[model samples]
Target: METIAFFNLKGGVGKTTSAVNIAWHAANEGIPTLLWDLDPQGAASWLLDSKAKSKAQPKKILNGKTPIGNLVKPTNYQHLDIIPADFSIRDLEQQLQLQSEQGQRNLIAKLIEPFSENYALIILDCPPSFSLLSEQIFDTADALYLPLIPTHLSLRTFEQTRDFFKKNKLKPKRLHAFFTMVDRRRSLHRLMLAHPPKMLKNGLPTPIPYAAVVERMGDHQAPLPAFDRNAHVSKAYASLWQDIKATLSDF
Candidate 1:
């Protein structure tokens, strides 16, 4: 499977929403998708209509007694499986760190190999941090999608991601940079988009518009298509999925 991680060091960038929606689109195309919720907040799980239990302990994906094959739960939507996030996943970074010291740096890769050929795509909803887990995601992902906002801090975070990769000396792969919740009316937003930050020149061709409909998905517990597929925001999301599929070359 093509393992893709949706990540942003900065939060509230619609990372989870994009992961879930894209997974849906991929499944709609007759490809089975596995959505792994790695965020401690469990927003992706919630969005998938899975109850995220904060107190429940999560199976150790790195070195747990039970293999991950049993953790897979079928989603309400066909061809979409989910690895629900429990708050205990917060400890994954620690476990990964220990595993790293023991010469197993590809903890995630090894943990993921079993399912690599089982699904067409694996969507990882990462936490908003540059922690050990995040590093693992960056290192192992076939593609990394960053949801950037039109703001100075967001740009800074994007720079940090690049610098981190540089420090690690990783060969570049499919890295996507796209603007999210973009407001065209705002002068700052327009300026950022018109000028086109250097990071984005080689990235996505479209910017996701700032639309209330997109935000309403959280409260409504549904994807944009469920509410109104022809809505402006829905169209933007569908188009974004199309572009991502082309970039990934497998959806």
Candidate 2:
């Protein structure tokens, strides 16, 4: 299965929202998608209306004490399943740091290997950080999707992330970014959307607009399309999903 992660070092950039929407779109297309909520906050899990059947420690899956498959819970959507995260996931970073470099890198890949036979795609909803867990995600995911807001500070963070990958000798081609929370009323946002930096020229063309509906995801506890498919924000996400599908085809 192809694994993709939605991540950003900076939070509040629509990372989890984008991951949830894309996974829902993939499942709607009958791709048999699995979304693993790796963030300790469990936002994606709650958004999808998925809950752990038992109060099992998520770290058990990491140490092999529990079968990863046992944690998989079907979401309200068809062809979509989720492995919800809880506070226990916060302990994984310390555990990963204790392993050798190779072990740290391969730990996540090994844990998700069994799902390949069932899922065509696995989406990881990652936390906002630069730690050993993030390193494992970088090594395990086939592609990493970054959500950026159209602002000077956001671009600065993007540059820092790019430098991190370069310094670490990670494959830069695996990184793909897109614009989020874009407000055309602001001249800077309009300018960036019209002519992004050369590095971001490769980003997905469709930008998710700043909308109340997008923010209401918590109130709805469902994907945009599920609650208001006709909303412009919902359509934007649909278009973004198409762009992502075409982009992943290359890999």
**lDDT of each structure?**
0.80, 0.86
Residue ranges of candidate 1 with Cα displaced over 4 Å: 52-61
Candidate 1: lDDT of 134? 80
Residue pairs with backbone atoms closer than 3 Å in model 2 (clashes): none
lDDT of each residue in 68-177, candidate 2, tens digit only: 88889999899999988853655776667665545444677888899988998999999999887788888888888899999989988888877788888888777888
Cα deviation at 212, candidate 1, in Å, is: 1.1
Predictions: Cα RMSD each: 2.1, 1.7
lDDT of 1 at 187: 94
lDDT tens digits, residue span 115-232, model 1: 9768988889999888878888888888898989889989898888887887898634556888889999899999998898876655676788888777777886766776678887
